[model samples]
Target: MITLTGRLICADAAQAALVQLYLPDHIRLTRAEPGCLSFDVVPTSDPLVWQVNETFTDRAAFDAHQTRTRESRWFKETAHIRREFRIIG
Candidate 1:
């Protein structure tokens, strides 16, 4: 199994709301992908901070997720946001 944890912090309130507005589509598409064990995005105490927790069946699954995400509109829109992540097993 593969686990990915991260935090995405928007540049400002407008950007944060933009991310929140598109999260539902992002979650739905990601959850529908094969080998997706779990994908979660949670709001932190800071309004601009979004916590990410994702799990996949294996490295291939994780790679596929990364590829798909990189091709998504949500990913492109959030490109300027600060993101930090770590992979674990």
Candidate 2:
């Protein structure tokens, strides 16, 4: 299994709004994907930050997630927003 942690920082109000609007679709797609063991989005106490946790069955699943997320319009729309991600075993 693999775990992914994502931290998103939205500095602009418009960017934040776009992130909020895109979140539901992101969650839905992640959860529905095959080999997805778990997916969660946690709002930080600071409104500008968001924490995402995801687990997948294996490397192939993780790669699939990458493909899907990269293809998503929401991801493209939010590309300008500051974000960081980490992967752990």
Candidate 3:
């Protein structure tokens, strides 16, 4: 299995708003992907930070997810936001 853990850090309220606006679609699409065992993005105690947790069947699945994300509206819209993440297998 492969897992990703992270936080999406928004610079300000405006950036955070973009997250709120796009996250549902992002979540839906990701969850619908094959080999996606689990996917979650949720707010932290700090409103500007969102915790991310994802699990996939293997490296191939994880890599595919990454590739798809780079081409997605979520990536384009939130490109300026900060991300602190790690991938584990």
Candidate 4:
């Protein structure tokens, strides 16, 4: 299994708005993917920061998720946001 834990840092309301705008679809699509064990993104106390947690059946699953995200509107809109993450497999 592979698990990813992260925080997406949004600099301002604009970035946070982008996240809110796209995150629902992103989460829904990711959770529907084959091999996805669990996926979630939730706002932190800071409001502008979001916590992300994802688990997959294996590295291949994780890689596929990455590929999909890179092609998604969520990634295109929030690409500039800073991410702090750790991966365990």
Cα lDDT tens digits, model 2, 1-89, are 99989999999678889989999999999999999999998889888889989999999999999899999987898989888989987
Model 2 residue 87 distance off true place after TM-score fit, in angstroms: 0.3
What are the per-residue Cα lDDT tens digits for candidate 3 across 14-76? Answer: 999999999999999999999999999999999999999999999998999999999999999
Off by over 4 Å in 2: none
List, residue by residue over 1-89, the lDDT tens digit for candidate 4: 99999999999999999999999999999999999999989998999999999999999999999999999999999999999999999
Task: Supply the global lDDT for candidate 1.
Answer: 0.92
Among the numbered candidates, top lDDT falls to: 3
Alpha-carbon TM-score of each model against the true structure? 0.95, 0.93, 0.98, 0.98
What candidate 4 gets wrong by more than 4 Å, as runs, is none
Model 1's number of clashes is 0
Q: Arrange candidates by lDDT, highest first: which order?
A: 3, 4, 1, 2
Clashing pairs in 3: none
What is candidate 3's local distance difference test score?
0.97
Pairs of residues clashing in candidate 4? none
- Winner by lDDT between candidate 4 and candidate 2: 4
Per-candidate local distance difference test: 0.92, 0.91, 0.97, 0.96
Could you tell me the C-alpha RMSD of candidate 2 in Å? 1.0
